[model samples]
Target: MGRGLGALIPDFDEDKAQVSELQYLAIEKIVPNPSQPRVIFDEEKMKELADSIKCNGINQPILVRKIDNAKYEIVAGERRWRACLMLKMEIIPAIVRELTDEESLQIALIENIQREDIGPIEEARAYQQLIKRFSYTQDELAQKIGKSRPAITNAIRLLDLPDEIIEHVISGTISAGHARTLLSLSVNEDRINALHKIINDKLSVRQAEDLVRRSMEIGKVPTPAKQAYVFEKESYIKENIWKKFTFKGNQKTGKFVFSYSSPEEKQELLNSLGIQ
Candidate 1:
């Protein structure tokens, strides 16, 4: 029986039918908001949910809006909609909402932010989208996202990293602490190398930050040779290398020095080599 909008909804009817107040159907729907701000989605997690739906069925409905003929756009529960598709369901439950272009984007951003599910990278990208696409100021973005302006600024600055560095951060190759250290550098290349060092050495955030601050305090960051010699060498090794090596004094002034074997040791080496 077809009932009016306010009529009582049946618990179960017609062999088997699923309905959800939260999801809607739209046909020929183009994404009203073509661009989304968030970046990360845990595909594995979503697939797990899809598997659950396959076994138990979709208990919750997704929200979609009809844009035109045979097209529907997702508004909320996008993951659920995706899961439903994965399950190869012909007819899926959804709640339809008539949302304007601006309203749809706003809803999507607000929902993701409120849920705090967006990754740091995604959050930064979203904030950037709001500014670039919507022409919103940093202050305005902060207000909308309920964050401080500085927080927003730091998040956005993260995008300035080289793609490799960003990948490192995304893959857990580098800690967020180390990423922040790289972010503090003026040059992206330096940041990238610093990131590599941090990962290779497994330096703590504090250690990385200190290194950065030290570099800034000095007129020029020490060259790799100097850095290795001065900061990395032990006193005993430095003395031994200095005493044994015959090299240029100015060149030897830096952190490293090479050790030379004594004459007696060299003779012993020659005897061992059968060159006496």
Candidate 2:
């Protein structure tokens, strides 16, 4: 057992319970923590760890909570358990503790966050789950996780993004910084447009922010009566044809700009509008 796990359990007496006396249980009986924040595991790193375990064996005992006489839920060391499973290890050294669900979730979150193993979105989702499931306020969550209130607030705000953009963040297609910038656009259509632009243009975080800000400002600009008809026409197009296009100029002289990443998408848009 590592000193880290020993620190969590006050009754751990290494001298009384020799290293050889540590409890070793069948690997199959242990289940992963439902509240585990880390979803993606680096396969290369896991393979490396597995190879090392094959040579030297797991140095630390995994921490688990007894669910029943025959069942256990891992509180920490899921990565180690995974590595051991990779090596086809039958039995694993473990320490069982009596823990509540809240304690289990907190410990799991702290372990992953401390190790920096979880992604930003994963961390946000963990915070959200903690708040929703445990009725934790933002301030309370911030204090518990050693983060500031604004940091906690921002993390939870990430959930407001559409599922498509959230998928991009989770998949590493765009960074958390980029996602934060997109939050400036309140409209879903505007946010989705900005997301496409970011991916297609490989826009930096600052650039994405500037682009969204400029677009928002343009939308907010006051229109003169001469241009009111043009703006109304633009609104109609946006509401009916596509909300992603840009309309400029006036009723007498106006330009409509439509952007598409591919010819296929352009053709699809044209087909949707009954245009050849």
Candidate 3:
């Protein structure tokens, strides 16, 4: 199923361990999944989570599988595990399950994508790893991850951007939208200048897009243009925001609505943006 870890994990109450598999395993015995998709965890968010766990304790048990008589590997709940470690928690509630390497990777990937604000570059690298390790076709992987094929294509496309641009995407200095807009320019110098403008000037996606478009029309980076209009509230226009949504129109103008066929898919997008 495309439902991520939720598909593999059984539903249970947060107040208590309702599943019989729940056990309080020593934290020292657990090791991180080698194929874990997330590299960077938000420091502020991690502290926030630690505070929550400190006050309330873990609401859900982590998932792990025995690697040897004395060792275990995390199947999911790495963030929870990490948080408990921060608290110097000696043992964590966990559910032991026997899963293959591919299953472990798949669960971790979906869990992060659906539940965390994983960066586009990290996300793309995760997809790349899954494809390279498992020899999965884009379509198959799309279905497995509960994302559209075009969505996968768009995410992976960000990997081809300059490493500097990729670093910006990972660091949240600039957005994947800005990087993708830079992809429109074939010249490295122009792309780098546009990236600097994005960081220094703090440009929006539409502004960046317009900037790139102008640079493409001219040979070099042109002068910044005046605003067409300013709005009172944020989210000035829906059409111009640089999300990885599918666009329908072409060359000059296009329209796309944030449509989702399932609640899970919709919620995943919202979680990625840190929206409630």
Candidate 4:
């Protein structure tokens, strides 16, 4: 069996192996780790990094593990490597260490987390991989990554969202906050409906929460005066404001919806209505 990360790094001192023994390896000989936790790299950011590298060169060396006498697999600094590759750099500085699959994944995950480059969904997937592949518990994974156990638990919970919702979270269409709000709904259909409303109305996290709460209260007895007042407000908004507008609720419970195709359109609609 392969050894755990502690056996290889011993308090992560090995990460600093580059300080004394940095070596310049041919870029062509190094490859990205297949188990790398981060899947998305911002192209604009990569271009910016490449421009900086062209001006100043790589200030930090990449971390790699010797795959064979002739090849190396990157354990960290894949973004730097990509930037260097964009500049067609012939050779790049690196620190090569011997690592098992587990060590490589742990290092990659830690590096990405430290850099804040990986998204929440990707982070959840990484935690899932560690649990399934390495038989790690939530507490153990949290300890390995220096996160609180509840944080790890919450991240993994994101995977239970529908694929469509997960795509929105990954694409920055909705935030992790909005995703968590959706999770509070017990029905999948309600969750999906709320997701549509969130994107269509450009709901903020607080608004999303209110929408979930109102949806949950749908079948309950309505307060007559409050319901009538809310209905009047919805009627007024629909007639005087946006034709796509919708309002649902009773006295203390209600949600407003205004649909738009894009953020620019939404802003234009708000501006047209003299709303800030």
Alpha-carbon error at 216 in model 4, in Å?
Answer: 0.6
Candidate 3, 51: how far from true, in Å? 1.6
TM-score of 4: 0.72
Query: What's the C-alpha lDDT at position 23 in model 2?
Result: 88
Every model's TM-score? 0.62, 0.68, 0.71, 0.72
User: What is candidate 2's lDDT per residue for 1-276, written digit by digit as tens?
Assistant: 233534533333535433343589899899888667765666678778888989998888898888988889998898888888777788999887777786677667656655655677878887787788778799876766567999978877889999768867875778999999988878887787778777767889999888888889896312222212224464466558764466656557877876443234457678867999
Candidate 2 whole-model C-alpha lDDT, 0 to 1: 0.73
Pick by TM-score: 2 or 4, better one: 4
lDDT of 4 by residue, 147-184 (tens): 89999899999999987688668758789999999898
Error of 2 at 32 (Å): 2.4
Q: What C-alpha lDDT values do all the predictions have?
A: 0.58, 0.73, 0.71, 0.74
lDDT of 3 at 115: 61
Minimum summed lDDT over a 10-residue window in model 3 is located at 226-235
Q: Model 1, stretches more than 4 Å misplaced?
A: 1-34, 38-40, 51-60, 218-276
Model 4: CA > 4 A from native: 1-20, 219-276
The numbered model that scores best in TM-score is 4
* lDDT-better candidate, 2 vs 4: 4
lDDT tens digits by residue: candidate 3, 26-98: 9989988877776555557877889999999988888888889999999778888888877888999988777
